[model samples]
Target: MKLRPLLITASRWKQIQQPLYPWVVTVDRIMRHERLGNMPGPLVHLFSDYGGAHKESLYETTAVLYMDVDNSMPWQVERLRVRQHFLPDGRRMSFKGLNDVKKQQALIPFLQASDSIPGVLLVAAVHKSIKNLCWSKDVRPDWPSDRAMRHKWSPRTFERALHVSHLAGLMVGGLSNPGQEVFWFSDEDELFANPTASNDVGNLFTMFTSVYANHPFKQIGLGTTAIDEGDRYEEDHVALADLAAGSAADMLTELAKYAGHIPTKVAIEFPGEFSRKTEIITSWLGYSGGNLKKVMVVLEPQGKTGFSVMRLNW
Candidate 1:
């Protein structure tokens, strides 16, 4: 994919800022020929995954994949077939598992064929140094002391929940139809490991949707499941987001070294060492000509207090 400067519309950008992350950017792309409004009872399924949250990384990335339930079966079948082709013994396909050129090559055909399934991959990458600058002061500052005491969370968990909720709000605001049901499935993560934290996040997401997104839906469901225990097909969708998040995080980390000052509209060039993983990631980012639309919104810090949002294109 290519990189360019992006200008987000003011209204949409305002809604996306509800998380109050200080540095947030939203990028959206629709590749399907049919208009979203024309679709019948459009049920949205969102699968999310995150990467680069470790202390050593400069950027943390979150990826969310949105798909309509109407195309779920066919997409699931195609994914299963692809998995079987590569792993006859019935193993799972994961970003980490694609360790060699051969396995990475196996992904191209499936990704190419996935064009029939209308989907959108949305990614948000934030600079870790500023991620928690004014956490308590900015986010829900007026929360009752009692409620705050009851629903205590570490800053890290709060940040993770905030990302997921904000992404869900954006998805609903941009994609959902009236009376349509929306479901969210995420790969097991520490944010959801505790039942209380998970429930709190779910409640926060519902509130965010109703207040910020302003989209009416029949119902909203959230599920956090282990990859092995969850439906294989759904897990595959999460895996796709996982790969994207990892790739975006790695790309940003590498870009930061040479990008003394982030430019406006420049092609992405990693002059450093490129491993097999990087090769696969670059290829995936370059993919086009399908119903699977991809958008990457990079929120780079400008000064100590502000940031810039740019959309990367293919």
Candidate 2:
């Protein structure tokens, strides 16, 4: 993956030091789970192809769900492929590779099965209208370096969404385990080449380090980090993460229906065809206030806003 690097001159760094946004409204209690343990598997991976973008196109909202599973065999349902379908009414999604329904079927059962696996946690983060975000710009006036990197791969929308998704994953891992080591998606060759300045892997390491320096939330410790190349089909943990994210995306679409807006304008709206599946998924994740509990917390500019988080019992 060829990526443009963020080369910052000394003067540019000085400009970025100025506070663009003075105060931020952040969610206090995000990673609700307290009993986090050190395990060896993919720390956090995202899935966003589930067609859950927000309305108006001012900002596209994407939900990323990460899970850490105990070292074990992959889930039996890893082979299931949830394909997208189109019709006159709207869009429909279902599990392919088997003809149990031959039509659109509820994916909640698969989602529930994935969540039921032992030693698994489902942490969610939603990026809204990622393009409008301040951090999405590839070249800012403050940091006037043409070669400066913009998020991960694609620029504009994709870069912003990736940044938020990554932050969500990091917030979950950093807050949960404190000094726990996280495995980012990367390859050995790329890691060896850049180590600390690579696009996704190395940049993620640096972000984790920076967060550790100015730690917030609850947990405390000097966090550790690493990287990996996530293959959805072969890797069990990656597959699970994908399913979790996809599940959350589906749920978000369902929630939008009640809000008078449906994501992707899918013909088969949530609970429209899979009411039973919707019920099961809702019960598992539960509701945070009246919302579906997909997003725990959000940080944004003063005027602009994001998701809300539930109050922490702690």
Top candidate, metric lDDT: 1
Please write out the lDDT profile of model 2 over residues 127-151, one tens digit for every residue: 4533344453442455435335433
Clashing pairs in 1: none
**lDDT score for residue 66 of model 2:** 36
User: What's the lDDT for all of these models?
Assistant: 0.66, 0.34
For 124-159, candidate 1 gives per-residue lDDT tens digits of 777776565334565566654543423578876786
Off by over 4 Å in 1: 5-41, 100-105, 133-136, 143-151, 227-231, 265-269
- The 10 consecutive residues of candidate 2 with the worst lDDT sum are 10-19
TM-score of each: 0.82, 0.46
Per-residue error (Å), model 1, residue 224: 2.0
